[model samples]
Target: MLQTSPRCSLYLVTPLLSAAAANAFGEIFAEALEAAPVACALVRFVSGSEAHAAAIVAPLLRPARSADCALLIENDVRAAARLGADGVHVAGAGEDLAEAIKRLKPDRIVGAGSLSTRDEAMTAGEMGADYVMFGEPRGGAQTTGLASLVSLTERVAWWAEVFETPCVAFAQTIEAAGTLADAGADFVALGDAVWAASSPAAAVRDAQSVITRAGVGVP
Candidate 1:
């Protein structure tokens, strides 16, 4: 059975970080966690070996656990397993996703993203993904504009209404966080909207407020 929450919550995504950058962002990440309740955090790394990724994940693990946040490693199932992360966020609903589920299910989270069609999302859910993420930029491309946002919101609504698995909707801006939450996202993912802000902690607080207000009485 899939787990569900009473209301939408914040899901944070890190910018692609190198080892040095990851070290620097650790403090900021802790501050954001302190500011509000974050459901999960995806630690993305610049293209590198698993060892390099592990190095970055090791330090942040403590802070994430301290804050009661699920720490997910992006696109590196082995690293996640070896490092004892909460789970792995696979980028597509293909063999990679299936393998992650096979390897990590019943013990760890295995979320699927980069789904381009409703069928793909359904496939991910059927394959036992912990959650299906929509509106995340593919290949590091930026997804912006009102049209894209509308499409994402619609997708999230469709999933929330029809599926048991949770849906994560990526918001391009802080303002969009509430919109996504009101549209029925199980989790509103904030990337640049929080990391790029002047104060990430404050941004997290703002996101929390909006999500709380929008999620009021949402079934």
Candidate 2:
């Protein structure tokens, strides 16, 4: 069995916003995160095509960070450690994940992102991932409906139980987030709904309340 960290946490996905507004959006999240209770902040640094994304994101990983993904460089792993970020997640298959695990400790949270198929998710689990980030269930076209959400959640939950690997639920809206939480998601990852709201902080606060009300509050 792959070793799982005690800090397998409540992962919060960063809200999507205009790249031109990324820094300011980050600040909004940073402030809300500082106040809102959560286990970690998952930033998509290297997910982009920037040379310094890791250097830019590592500082955010330290104090207020619990889990994370996409450390840009081998050097960035050191930064993650320095920042006291519990985990450094990797995305994709045959990705240089081994190098990351080798660089960080074995128990560090090294998550795999965007596994759209069971085979893909299982492969990630077998390779010793701390968690497998199942892609969003329903957010596009006819896919964005209550039925789709329920169906996808059931499938993801089944996989999580079978593999004993935690599932990270990414919701596009507030109601969707609540549904995921109530559906027994281990960690709920919400974005756009809160950050892009007219009142980012207020929206997040309401989200915090809803998550708590749904009995999904992180310890």
Candidate 3:
């Protein structure tokens, strides 16, 4: 999270984008984006029928696109393509990075996550991934799980120093955002830390302020 490197932006992720939750969540997401600049927002659906998940994402497209925020669907290429999403976040190392790229290539984004080691991360970069994320919650990927703060900071700093592929450091708290910034993370990802706040928009503003204070410029 070095303040001296390329400017870092926020990468937002929804708690769960289910059909029953889209309308209410969309309102909060729109408010957050309006309050601060975001690199992208992932419409995450944990577990559900594909049809149901697709229906859930349908209502969220308008708000994110209108704000000019890239909206990515988590771990679902079919939904990303069919729903006209900006891209796809291929969670965990178990997923096929190459196939995902091929499926969505030359147009949509394909970010690789669930990286627990430098080799896996570098491999993703070599595979033509748009970005590689670390410290994100894992979905039972044996290769790697979320790393500790010390480990995450080191990983981000290492990647920022050596690689051009942008790295995202998942920040569970405002303080963690600053720490990641100092470590040279290319982006700070906010998940439960924002949505669980009493005011989601205010939370984003606060997160942005933290990143700025750390000497990391925001886009």
Candidate 4:
């Protein structure tokens, strides 16, 4: 189980780092971590060579490590083992959650994502998922719009009331981050909004502010 404080925190996702942008992206990511209380980071590679992605992720891991943020590779167990990542995030029901637990257990975090239903999320918990993520973009676009945000917040609130397993609610905007926190998310995951902001660090700081507000007066 991934024990976290009652207060919600941030979980950052990379903005598709190509091999050429590795070094630069590393620098930016490190700065973002310094700007807020980020609980974890999911290294997402939309489309690229896994080998190249690993090569880039290797150096970036140092920043996340230094900041005490758990670093999880997206959808690749082998790469997690090879890169010595903190854990692996298996997306969708298609991935073998059992096998992933078998490989990374007793040490690394094995989180589940792309879960659309309560049944799938419950199954993930039963399979020993360290945590289950909700509201994350499926097929890369659905979660960005406004409709998904409302649905995600409701799910986070529902899960928080009913389950002990940690829930990470992906927020497409800083406003959504605060909403999720108030609704009782353990961690709010930030996506393109952070990277697209004029100042990524400032964006994180802003998100942190929202979460802090939500934390107040909540018993």
TM-score-sorted candidate list, best first: 1, 4, 3, 2
Report the lDDT of model 2 for residue 66. Answer: 36
Encode model 1's per-residue lDDT on 1-219: one tens digit a residue. Answer: 224569888899988878777778898999999999898999888876456886788778988999889999999889889999999999879999999999998899999988878888899999899999897743445433224778888888889899989999898888888989999999999998898899999999999999988966643
Alpha-carbon lDDT, every model: 0.85, 0.56, 0.79, 0.83
Those runs of model 2 whose alpha carbons end farther than 4 Å from true positions after fitting are 1-10, 15-23, 46-49, 58-85, 136-147, 215-219
Candidate 3 local lDDT, 27-139, one digit each (tens): 88889998988878877875765678767787778877787778888888988888899888886455477778989987898888877678888988888888888877433
Question: Candidate 4 lDDT, tens digit per residue, 122-150?
Answer: 89988889998987754456542224767
Residue by residue across 1-219, what tens digits does model 2's lDDT show?
123333222345663223454556556666666555665456554335344554455455443533223222222455456545566656653555666667675645677665656677778778777666654422322232223666657755676557677766666677766666666566666656765678766766676666666643544
Candidate 4 ranges beyond 4 A from true positions:
138-140, 143-147, 215-219
C-alpha RMSD of each candidate structure in angstroms? 2.7, 5.6, 3.9, 2.4
Q: What are the clashing pairs of model 1?
A: none
Kindly indicate the candidate among 1 and 2 with the higher lDDT. 1
What's the lDDT for candidate 3?
0.79
TM-score of 1: 0.93
> Model 1, which residues run further than 4 Å from truth?
1-3, 138-147, 215-219
Worst 10 residues of 4 by lDDT: 138-147
lDDT score at residue 26, model 3, on the 0-100 scale: 77
